[model samples]
Target: MTNDPLKAAWQTANIPAHDDLQAVVRARGGHPVMSRIRRQLLLEGGCYILFLLVYYDFFDGHRRPLYLNIILVLSVACMLMQHLNGYLLASSALKGPDIFRSLQQKVLQLKQYAWLSVGSRVLGWCGIMVFFCTGITWTNAKYGLLAGAIIIMGVQMAMLWQLWQRRINRIKNTLAELNG
Candidate 1:
């Protein structure tokens, strides 16, 4: 309200009103945390798309039961949708009102995705089990398939847990620093 000449001069100048300050903020690169989150989201989103391609190639027109195929495709689609949504959320955070609020939203988004990862793992395991039980009969060769599936599922779950923990902790650490 008072004395700075620069403030007085700026107040006296005729400047066009901005429709949204977000555009001005966005003209500059956003916060570092947002950049990191965006990169992670893009990488994961690309992986999901790649997974869908591979799944389609491997399973399409196969002897696999229709229900199993449907479930697998739907599951992949759901996972992809989640990743895409996360990516959009992360991108939007860059345009948020302030750095702290942006960070808070990013953390919330990461946490939500971490929980989604757990759900994705559970859904995958259940889908595999259901596929085996309902669609495939137990045969001599099927034992290998069952064993391989179990090993792969175990590895997948372990990796997912590690990834989830790492991502969540990274964001939490950033939040802690910001809060402190």
Candidate 2:
């Protein structure tokens, strides 16, 4: 791996079409599997970040609503698990044997993460619904909605930025391989 930390990280984490496209391509036959894995990882990471934002915005301070707190806590846990699973998939995809095997493992891990993500989201959505239906003051409800929206956008942007960084590193690796 190159001395560049970002490049090295990308090389180890399997972000396709980055600096080391040639080696990555040669190693994996330019298979679509790598791209698919990358996309899935990005999506999962984005979702987790969004969930975190929602937790922070509304639940960070003040007396916690019992039902809302429980649901938020569970959602945060699930999101954390999903984030870890994504990182694992990225590392395994880069270093693991065959692309098929790597993908299989990624898919299995993703399945679990997906369930968690869905559950967490559901809990959050339901909590919001209940809060509104229970006739909570508009001020509280508005804050929750605002927080949720901010988190959604923030998480998406963060995930995309991470993906962009990986792509740049991959590009650098490709350049090095070509010149060498």
Best by TM-score: 1
Q: How many backbone clashes are present in model 1? A: 0
lDDT of 2 by residue, 5-85 (tens): 997887788556655776867687555765766677677678766755675556452355667556555655555565555
Off by over 4 Å in 2: 1-65, 94-99, 128-180
In model 2, what are the clashing residue pairs, if there are any? 18-170, 18-171, 19-169, 19-170, 19-171, 19-172, 19-173, 19-174, 20-170, 20-174
> What digit string (tens of lDDT, one per residue) describes model 1 on residues 83-111?
66666765653547877777777767777
- The deviation in Å at residue 161 for candidate 1 is 2.4
| Candidate 1 Cα misplacement greater than 4 A, ranges | 1-66, 94-97, 125-134
Find the 10 residues in a row with the least total lDDT in model 2: 127-136
**What would you estimate as the lDDT of candidate 1?**
0.70
Scored by lDDT, model 2 comes in at 0.58
- Least accurate 10 contiguous residues by lDDT in model 1: 55-64
